[model samples]
Target chain A: SQTIHQWPATLVQPVGSPLSLECTVEGTSNPNLYWYRQAAGRGLQLLFYSVGIGQISSEVPQNLSASRPQDRQFILSSKKLLLSDSGFYLCAWSVSSGLYNEQFFGPGTRLTVL
Target chain B: SQQGEEDPQALSIQEGENATMNCSYKTSINNLQWYRQNSGRGLVHLILIRSNEREKHSGRLRVTLDTSKKSSSLLITASRAADTASYFCATDESGGSYIPTFGRGTSLIVHP
Candidate 1:
């Protein structure tokens, strides 16, 4: 079965510090990957999605960026973090861009910027 | 918005009782899906109902979709304390739009 993995299950970062979160998928090939940020008691906000390597689409303009360095490896980075950047980060993968877009998520990363 | 907004933001009930949650969206969709999230964890896909279909069942979950009303409901029968979690609904439009919007989920607490 396919599974997604996210790193740093919990993180505490100081303001102005750099941020890096990684996500990888196993048992699947050429899967579509997405990055989402969710506030406490709030829905998810799409930050970035990639259909293939070196291709990324950003949804919201903010202090975060995403990169697909490999087929199944996605990275979320920021040069400097902001207080508003604190939230639960989720990584998800879908079958592809066409039919059966059902998404499977990875264990999230909770970041607290102090 | 393309998101499905849930009603009764929070619900509490006793175990073995029936729990129902409603979700409404603003546009046409190919399908609607329900997900469950335990506290501080990832979401698990619970059930999915297609626009062409009115109802679907899996285990103890019953999902109904009303395309005309652009609404969907999730009914959980014989609820248990282990079923306590946040429930979210998401809509997938007919077109090829890949971005999915999700509303603040409905929090459910089942006391044993």
Candidate 2:
């Protein structure tokens, strides 16, 4: 079975500080990874998605960026965090090029920018 | 652009009652998926209905898709307090677009 892991489970970052969240997939190779943010009482906003190493697609322009350093390793980073950058961040992975595979989610990282 | 938008942003229902949430989307799709999120945790995939299919069942959950109107509904039978969570609908236009677009989820509260 495939599983996704994300950490730190919870984060508290001061304003203007840097942020780094990591996501890794187990039991799968060449999976498509995605980063999503959910504001309180709002819908999820897709931040970035990566198909392969060194490749990423930004869905929305924000203070965050994502990278696929390895086939199953994805990282979401921010040079300087903003108050608006706080939200419940999720990492998901799906079978690469699969006909109808659902995206599996990680436990998720709750970031609070104070 | 968001492909799905849920109706009645929030719903409150008593335990043992049926809970139904609706999702509307734009464009044609290959399938529509329903997901549930508890508190601030990651979402769990509930069910997926393909375009050719009209309804699907998984345990106590039922999903119906209306392609002509570009809408879908998730029905939970005999809900419980533990079932209180937010539900989201994601549309996959698998014809050529590989990305699955998600919508603003519907928050369902099942009070015991």
Candidate 3:
């Protein structure tokens, strides 16, 4: 069975501060990783997705960025945070196959930028 | 732009009653899926119905897809309080791309 893990289940950051959220998957290799953000009472916004290491596709151009350092390790970072950056960050992984594989999600990180 | 949209932003029903939510989408899709999210937690995939299929069942969940109308519905039978959660529908476009576009989701509350 494959499992996903995210760190800093909850985070409080000040404006203009740096941000780093990590996600890793076990029991799977070369999986598709994605980063998503959900604002209060809003739908999820896809921030970034990576099909392989060192490859990242950004959906919405914003202050946040994502990187896949290893086959199963993904990181979301920001040089300077904004108030609008506050939201629930989620990490997901799916099988690297054809279209239409169900994605598995992690516990998620609740980030609050004050 | 959101590819899918869920109807009735919120719904409340008594336990044991049936709860049904609808989802509409734009563009052609290879498949549509339903997910459940508990308060302040990650989402769990509930069921997936391919575009070629009309309906599918998994335990208490029954999902129907109308490709002609570009819509889908999720019916939960004999709902329990534990079923209170936000339900979202995602669509995988017909193209080879595997990315799924998500909807705003419908919040369902099962009163005990």
Candidate 4:
């Protein structure tokens, strides 16, 4: 069985501060990793996705960026956060075999930029 | 714009009753997936239906996909209070791209 872990389950950061959120998956190698953000009472928006280490494709342009430092480790970071950057950030993984595979998500991180 | 849109943004029903949610998408797709999310929690994948397939079942849940209409329906039979959650539909666009685009979701509340 595979498990995904994310931390600082909840975070409060002041505007203009640096941000870092980490996601790690165990029991899976070379999995496709993705980063998504959801606003209050809204649907999720894909921010970035990675096919392999050091390879990331961003879906939307904003204050955030993603990196795949290791095969099973993905990090979402920002040099300076903005108030609009506050949202529920999610990490997901899927098999790289097919184009239509189901994604497994982590618990998620709640970010509040005040 | 969102590729997929769920109907009836919110629904409330009594436990033991059947719950049905609909999703409509625009564009060719290789597959459609359904996911459930508890309040303040990450989403859990429920089921996936390929474009070539019409219907699929898992436990008490049934999903039907109509490729011609570009729509899908998810049916939960004998719903329970624990089944209260937001359901989202995602589409895997045709072509080799493996990304799945998600909709806003339909919030379902099952009263016990």
- Candidate by candidate, in order, the iRMS in Å equals 1.4, 1.2, 1.0, 1.0
Consecutive 10-residue window with the lowest summed lDDT within model 2 chain A: A94-103
TM-score of each: 0.97, 0.96, 0.99, 0.98
lDDT tens string, model 2, B8-90? 79999999999999999988988789999998889999998889999999999999999999999999999999999999999
List candidate 1 stretches off by more than 4 Å.
none
Better of 1 and 4 by DockQ: 4
The local lDDT score (0 to 100) that residue B83 gets in candidate 1 is: 95
Best by DockQ: 4
Which 10-residue window of candidate 2 chain B scores lowest in summed lDDT? B92-101
Per-residue CA lDDT of candidate 2, range A1-114, in tens?
888899999999999999999999999899989999988887778889888899999988888898888899999999999999999999999888756758899999999999
> What CAPRI class is candidate 3?
medium
User: What number of clashing residue pairs does each candidate have, in the order they appear?
Assistant: 0, 0, 0, 0
Please list the C-alpha lDDT of all candidates, in the order they appear: 0.90, 0.90, 0.94, 0.95
Docking class of 1: medium
DockQ of candidates 1 onward, in order?
A: 0.70, 0.69, 0.78, 0.82
In model 1, the Cα lDDT at residue A21 comes to 100
Q: Kindly report the docking quality category of candidate 4.
A: high
Model 3 spans > 4 angstroms off: none
TM-score of chain A of each: 0.98, 0.96, 0.98, 0.98
User: Higher lDDT: candidate 1 or 4?
Assistant: 4
Candidate number that wins on TM-score, 2 or 4: 4
True lDDT of residue A40, candidate 3: 86
Q: Write the per-residue lDDT of candidate 4 for residues A69-103, one digit (tens) a residue.
A: 99999999999999999999999999988666899
Question: RMSD in angstroms, candidate 1?
Answer: 1.0
RMSD of each: 1.0, 1.2, 0.7, 0.8
